[model samples]
Target: MENSTIVPKSSLDFLTQLKENNNKPWFETNKPKYLIELNHIENFAGALLHELSKTDVLETASGKKSVYRIYRDIRFSKDKTPFKTFWGGSYTRATKERRGGYYFHIEAGNSFFAGGFWGPNAADLKRIRTEFAHDTEPMQKILSSKSFVSNFGTLQGEQLKTAPKGFDVNHEAIDLLRYKQFLVIKRFTDDEVLSPNFLEQALETFKNMRPFFDYMSEVLTTDINGASVL
Candidate 1:
């Protein structure tokens, strides 16, 4: 796979293979191919992150951290994938833990790249929900923007104060379980509508919303929104 330019076809397939053959021995067998794919995925994700940051709409979180971790935890799940082929995006500032960033998942006619809170664990989700509550007005305003609507469809602001139907938001061990990452997971149908140029337009829209995140970061720290909360 290293010398080949196309690389492996499906990320799901790679994961499935890893899960099928459990044990260090199996991993060692596929180590070379896995490393190559991992490198490719990292390069692509890094490029996308850099591109978004250059626009001033998004800022890459920095500091001592890891990029493109290929480890997979399948302890509870019946299906196990030893490693992941695709690299998800993440960012953090100096000395800060890599809590939230950006991630792009591509699927057949269902491609979406998410920004905002990307925490898969409990504490991160709580903090994001709290932030959302504190800055609900501005968050809604950003959601209502023409750009956001055009790309992701209408969004409803759900307060984290209440527990979701299947989720135990109040469970003592709730913080231990992984939760959805983004406060907002903008979804787009992979149709004729989602061309390269269309994605570029969406990126610009997200860039436009970057100020909202910066504003919310401050507002979350200080419960005051100055004059206009929105």
Candidate 2:
């Protein structure tokens, strides 16, 4: 970091060290260190929000509103760790409706930023698939764009083995229609985050991927503003 970075070396060190000692006793003893790291993450989220606001409207883009808690929900998980070994956050709309959003994860060696809606419910999934059936061109353009592909590689997450219900097997966009989740991600090394130009890289990554997010946002948006036919 030339001057200073929101996420410094110590933040990464804290998380990496925590992985070895992931018990309450260790955590209780090192709570101050954890809080400092968490604060750094919060500041980083705020900085990202500022960058995104220039291109898009992040309705709920504050640190407190967007940062995720470190506490793990081990209710039904196999690895029942008491806390997380990473610091994370999101920049998204305030509404409960499913839509595209931004995510940031900072761990020891696994720093990354991911965007797009993940695992929408049955109804939302139906809506997205229905939109694809009507006109695949819009999403196709986004998927095939040079910048989009370069940044995110391709749409990711689980996909169905066959065509989804209500969509024909022989449909023109059958390949895309088989997708159950619409997501993309960009990974970074710990050194990358610690670089002097990390913030610039972060902003550019988000900007490059904004078009895809906008496309998915349009797909999931449900507004009933038209005059009632009835």
Give me the candidate number with maximum TM-score. Answer: 2
Q: Note the Cα lDDT for every prediction shown.
A: 0.49, 0.79
Runs with alpha carbons beyond 4 Å of true place in candidate 2: 1-5, 94-98, 222-230
Local accuracy of candidate 2 as per-residue lDDT tens digits, 1-230: 32333568888899888899888899999999888777777777777787778877678647667788888899999998888988888887545433577788888889888887686889778877887888889889988999888888888878999999878999999988898877888999989988868888888887887777666656667522322222
Tell me the TM-score of model 2: 0.88
Segments in model 1 whose C-alpha atoms lie over 4 Å from true places: 1-24, 57-66, 74-81, 84-86, 93-100, 105-111, 118-137, 154-182, 187-211, 225-230
Name the lDDT value of residue 29 in candidate 1. Answer: 85
- Cα RMSD, each candidate: 8.1, 3.3
Q: What is the lDDT of residue 167 in candidate 2?
A: 87
Q: Could you give candidate 1's per-residue lDDT for residues 49-118 as a string of tens digits?
A: 5566665433444311225466767799775655543434455422232223454554444545555654
Cα misplacement distance, residue 226 of candidate 1 (Å): 2.6
